[model samples]
Target: MFKNIVRNIFLEAENANVKKYVKQISGADKLDPIIVIKPNPTWVANYGWIAYNNAMDQFAIYNLNNNQRRDKNSRCIFHFRDIQELHTVQDGICNRNLIPNGFHVPQGLQANIALGTNNPVPIGRAYLVINLEIKKLEFLEDKKFFYVD
Candidate 1:
């Protein structure tokens, strides 16, 4: 199901840059990466604050701000700390204008994550699952960033 969505995005995306990025990442040998996302205020307001171990695997998320060419249904990501600050803002504003942040897999767990062998690295509020063999990007869940014990 999720694979089809990403496949459609790769095939039907209007943005040239997005297509190019998809090509690059899809074909790359390494997919050890992190998906950076700010808190979704709507989700929090409706469902209360985000908690650790919460699965945030929402594919085909709507683009709230479609102001840029690269803002083509991408995830919420700006600076690294936006994950922490997103839950604190009272205003409706969010990290919709920034580029998506995904980084290379660390050396230690690259094999485990790539192979999907009980590799659950703590990435702040991000839960990212990447299977390079199938060229699939799966989101795990989000966790509470601030005000946690």
Candidate 2:
């Protein structure tokens, strides 16, 4: 489950920074992503690791960011989708979960409904997939607005 799944995940990150780094090293982007027993997230950008996975806690949970070299040190190349398989059912809520009960999604984003997906591992949890930089992760309060597809 681990090896095959990770191999597939790496394939999904074909555009990962390691590929670009390897290309710059010796013109080869084929260096397979190395998986350490337990990786330190802070050391990721410094060591140029394509991905660094910290172990899951009691509930067995983790998250990943997109592929980008945001700072001068470590470039984050994590994708939250590939590793975790979200199997929650959206009963017309995820489409507009961010809006107030009486409100609705804007007409412009209505056509893009096909782009949304369910929450993470557990079902019925309100994991807002917003479009802003969240300094810290916290549960959404009632009647508040957030950006979601």
Candidate 3:
């Protein structure tokens, strides 16, 4: 439910750049990335918060869990011109920690998150997945900033 709402808000955002990146990376020129966000459903999983942060930057993740490796999905990132992205990825994937995983945060998405009654024990260390390609990584920053609303 949250994803849908966020997606819709992004679609309507102004002074932001989500729509631009969608056209550049998606290569469809039809606003596909705006709705699908790179066509990856299971986008970005995390055992804890480590890979969750890394997926947004350029520290390309390698499945830490063996059995559930196949379940990993593309980490849906909200690339924006926030204070964090300004420093790191300045050259390309610099920071290794979020302090509080700062990059994963955009428009204060972290604040909106609620521990749904069932925060189950992690089944594996499959922390984070994303559909970004190594080549298009630099293009992330070019997108306009988007707020969750």
Candidate 4:
């Protein structure tokens, strides 16, 4: 069925070699700031994005170059109180932002500015993972790339 095909794609996308290549291209030591969500009950997905928060303190901050704080106010800021705010914002804007096919970029992948700062301008990516359990005889085809910048 279609579920099988999707599962195969996901498997290939997350293979060992693919992960190694992604790591090299992204230059990320570790995959942090990973978001896992269960949007449905049939399939699970995994995504990777850049982390902007201090790993030790678990605090998120805007990566800026200078002292200018004007842009900081306009860009999305994340805090303990803004968890849901971030999720909602991401859900709302996930579909509009899609990365063009090039280099190691895979199909059905997207990116957006999850958070920003005024100083140097933030340059990072975010990741997402989904888990689903399929049951019964069903044909689920609702697939779209979702992520926050």
In TM-score terms, which candidate is top?
1
Using Cα atoms with residue i matched to residue i, what is each candidate's TM-score against the true structure?
0.26, 0.16, 0.21, 0.20
Question: Which 10-residue window in model 2 sums to the lowest lDDT?
Answer: 51-60
Report, for every candidate in turn, its global Cα lDDT versus the true structure: 0.33, 0.26, 0.29, 0.26
- Candidate 1 lDDT at 125 equals 41
Model 3 segments more than 4 A misplaced: 1-14, 25-51, 57-149
Q: What lDDT is reached at residue 126 by model 2?
A: 20
lDDT of 4 by residue, 1-149 (tens): 32343343344444554444333323211221223121211111112122211121121222223553311221212222233534543443323222211012122232323222111211222223222222222222322223222
| Lowest-sum lDDT 10-residue window in model 4 | 39-48
Which regions of candidate 1 fall more than 4 Å away from where they truly are? 1-31, 36-39, 42-125, 135-138, 144-147
User: Model 2: per-residue lDDT, tens digit, 1-149?
Assistant: 22232233334445464455323222112222211112233334433242222111101222223432211222222112211222121223234342122122345665665534321111111222211222321222122122234
The C-alpha RMSD of each candidate to the native structure, in angstroms, is: 14.6, 17.9, 16.2, 15.3
lDDT of 2 at 107: 50
